[model samples]
Target chain A: MTEEIIIAGFGGQGVLSMGKILAYSGIMEDKEVTWFPSYGPEMRGGTANVTVILSDTRISSPVLHEFDTAIILNQQSMDKFEKAVKPGGVLLYDPNGVIHPPTRKDIRIYKVEGTRAAVEMGNPKVFNMIVLGGYLKVKPVINLANVERGLQKSLPERHHKLIPLNLEAIRKGGEILEAN
Target chain B: MGELRLMKGNEVLAEAAVRCGCDGYFGYPITPQSEVMETLMELRPWETTGMVVLQAESEVASINMVYGAAATGKRAMTSSSSPGVSLMQEGISYIAGAELPCLIVNVQRGGPGLGTIQPSQADYFQTTKGGGHGDYRLITLAPASVQEMHDFVELAFDLAFKYRNPAMILTDGALGQMMEKVELADQKPRWTREEILARSGSWATTGKTPDRQRNVVTSLELDSEKMEQNNIRLQAKYQQIEENEVRYEEILCDDAEYLMVAFGTSSRVCQKALEVLREQGVKVGLLRPITLWPFPSKVIGEMARKVKGILVVEMSAGQMVEDVKLAVFDACCCVPVAYTGRMGGILPSPGEVVEAFEQKLLKR
Candidate 1:
């Protein structure tokens, strides 16, 4: 199976890191993964996006025009990637700063109060993990065990203490996802 | 087995250089490719492997440093993006003239002049056609994936030393920034001074010895006839490389009616387009040139005779397409060769490639 995903949001929203964790999880499961980021000036406090692809076979292209899933965290990303999602695909977003929500009829949409959940958890940095948790709950492409392993691998040794917290945030995300 | 991990192409380049026993790395910082030097500094290969990593003040200084280290038979390298690479053209020409073995990486960004920080293959002409002045050719390797990015470091070094000529890894911002699973080569020990003497002592200016004449490294020759001789020798070496070092990959070409020629990032896009077209019953194939300097003209010539048309895809106005046309001309084939591309850091999508093929080749 192949899953082409795009995760987009503000630079500090952990958009790139969430994709990195997902990519690491795919590697742990012996799947081929590619994480291509839209870098340069756009990443410096502007809208940042990363395209992550996981496949059983060799990935053909790292840059793509369409995605099987689009995980959006901000209105800019939602507006940019909402139409890029494929029919029957999944679009997960956190409606924190989004003024206009996605209005796609063909794709399945889900909302997670990532910023609110992270604030409640007393760590705003874990907002991305919550959004990721909501995505995993909806798609179930990768298991939580693999994701935990992914978090361990992607994070440095000094930050290993935060893995449990991130896991908690992810679970909280799954519990709070709302169909839209 | 080698160590496996997920890494960005630029970071993996630094890691591979360290693991491949590279003697030194000298580079300046540039967008889309700054990670190469940053990772090297972070790894502290100087402390671990006795490898030297230095950030030169400028691109010119960095390349000249590579030239100086390489003249002594050391495996030295430098990396930069489009604009910075442009600044190194003179040094690169001098390195090629001196026939020094060194690695240069151009993680290309779009440019006429600091155009954008996004990835582009516009440097194809600058790289494969001798960006620097005079008649010189660098053994250019285009990596389409992060895995190839890791593998080509050793390969480029080997080719550079084997031919006593400079080699380059031509990549782009996309590959440089993209992360993928890579099986890194095991660490090889840096060459000892004696090993350098044994391997490259014949020409390298290692040191004056009692048993042999002093080895002098210089591209300068005041005598006109001697300079002519030097040029002839350089040309002969390039021809030899063309014969022995051409590398490329062919996919689904056995029964292809049309062929797509691309390299580096464009090749990856073509691969995706090939799949989509095949599903729609279009008999199209992809030819990815791994080595750009040699140009793979021979194979393209042969394919040109069989395919009804050829589509040249790149992230430039049109550079590699000229080589494809030349290949077709050499083969005495009258097949139509069309060019489609994106410039200034915009990568053409797979749908665009398919549409270009259908519009330029199929309808015509």
Candidate 2:
């Protein structure tokens, strides 16, 4: 099975890192994975996005025109990637700061109040992880155990203490997700 | 499997250099490829393996440094993007003229002059058909994946020394920045002074002794006759490389009625296009040339005889397509050749490639 995903948001929203964590989790499960980012000037402060692919066989193109899932964090990303999602695919987003919500009736739309959830959890840094947890709730392509291992692999040794907090944020994310 | 890790293509290039016993890396940082030097600096190979890593003043200085280090029979390399690579052309020519073995990586970006920092394959003509002043050919390897990016460092260095000719890894910003799971090779120790002397002792300028004549590494031969002979010898070496060093990958070509020829990032896109086309009941195949300099003309010629039409896809405006045309020209086949691509860092999607094939070749 192949799952092609696009995670997009403002540069600091951890869009790239979210894709990286997912890719690492795929690798931990012995799946072929690729993480392709939108780099250079756009990454400075503009919209940032990453394409993550996990497949049973070797992956072909990292640059794709469509995605099986689009995890959009901002209104701009929702505006841009909502149409790019496959007809019957999934569109997950955070409702914070979004002016217009996704209106696609063909695809499954879900919202996770990640920004508010992170603030409530007393650490806004776990916003991306919360959103990731929401994605796992919907898809569950990768197991939670592998995701913990992925967190261990991706985070530095000094940051190991934050894994539990991140896991807490992830669980909160799964709990707060709303079907739209 | 030596060590499995998910790494960006540029970072893996540096890691591979360290693991493959590279002696020195002299490079100036540039976008889409600065991670190469950054990772090398972070690793500090000097502390572990005595490898020298320097930030040169400019691309010109870095390539000349490579030339100098290579003169001592050391595995040396430098990397840059398009405009920076353009600056190193003269030094690259000098290295090739001196017949010094070295690796030069161009993690290419869009360019005519300081173009976008995004990926593009526009350097196809410049790299494959002599970017430097004289008639010199760099053994160019085009890597489509991050894994190939890791694997080709040692391969390029080996080929460079095997022929005592400069070799290059011609990749784009897309492949350089993308991350993928890679199984890195085992670490190999750097060559000792004694080993360098023993292996390249015949002609290396490693402080000549009384047992042999002074070995002078120079590309300058003022005499016209001597220069002509030098060119002749270089041409012969290039011919030998063409015969033995051509590398390419064929996907589903046996039953294909049409074929697509591409390399690097474009090849990856074409792979998807091949699948899309096949799903639409189109019999298409893909030929990915791993060695861009050798051009894989023989295989293209052989494939052209069987296919009805061929589509050449690149990130440039029909650069490698010329070589594809030349390859098919000699086959004496009436097959048509079409070109499809994107420029200035925009990658063509698989749907676009499929549309181009149908529009140009099938006239639908």
Give one digit per residue, the lDDT tens place, for model 1 in B1-364. Answer: 7777999999999999999999999999999999999999999998889999999999999999999999999999999999999999999999999999999999999999989999999999999889999999999999999999999999999999999999999999999999999999989999999999889999998889799998989999999999999999999999999999999999999999999999988999999999999999999989999999898999999999999999999999999999999999999999999999999999999889989998999993
Per-residue CA lDDT of model 2 for A39-82, tens digit only, reads 96754578999999999999998888899999998888988999
Residue by residue across B1-364, what tens digits does model 2's lDDT show? 6788999999999999999999999999999899999999999999999999999999999999999999999999999999999999999999999999999999999877988999999998888888888989999999999999999999999999999999999999999999999999999999998999988988799997888999989999999999999999999999999999999999999999999999999999999999888998999999999999888999999999999899999999899999999999987777899999999999999889989999998899
How would the docking of model 2 be graded? high
lDDT (10s digit) by residue, model 1, range A1-180: 999999998998999999999999999888999999988675457988999999999999787889999999888888889999999999999888999989989999999999998999899999999999999999888989999999999999999999999999889989999998
| C-alpha root-mean-square deviation, each candidate | 1.1, 0.9
TM-score of 1: 0.98
Worst 10 residues of 2 chain B by lDDT: B326-335
Please give the range of 10 consecutive residues that has the lowest summed lDDT in model 1 chain A: A38-47
**What lDDT is reached at residue A41 by model 2?**
74
RMSD to native, candidate 1: 1.1
Report how far residue A12 has shifted in candidate 2, in Å.
0.6
**How well does model 1 score by local distance difference test?**
0.94
Predicted complex 1: CAPRI docking category = high
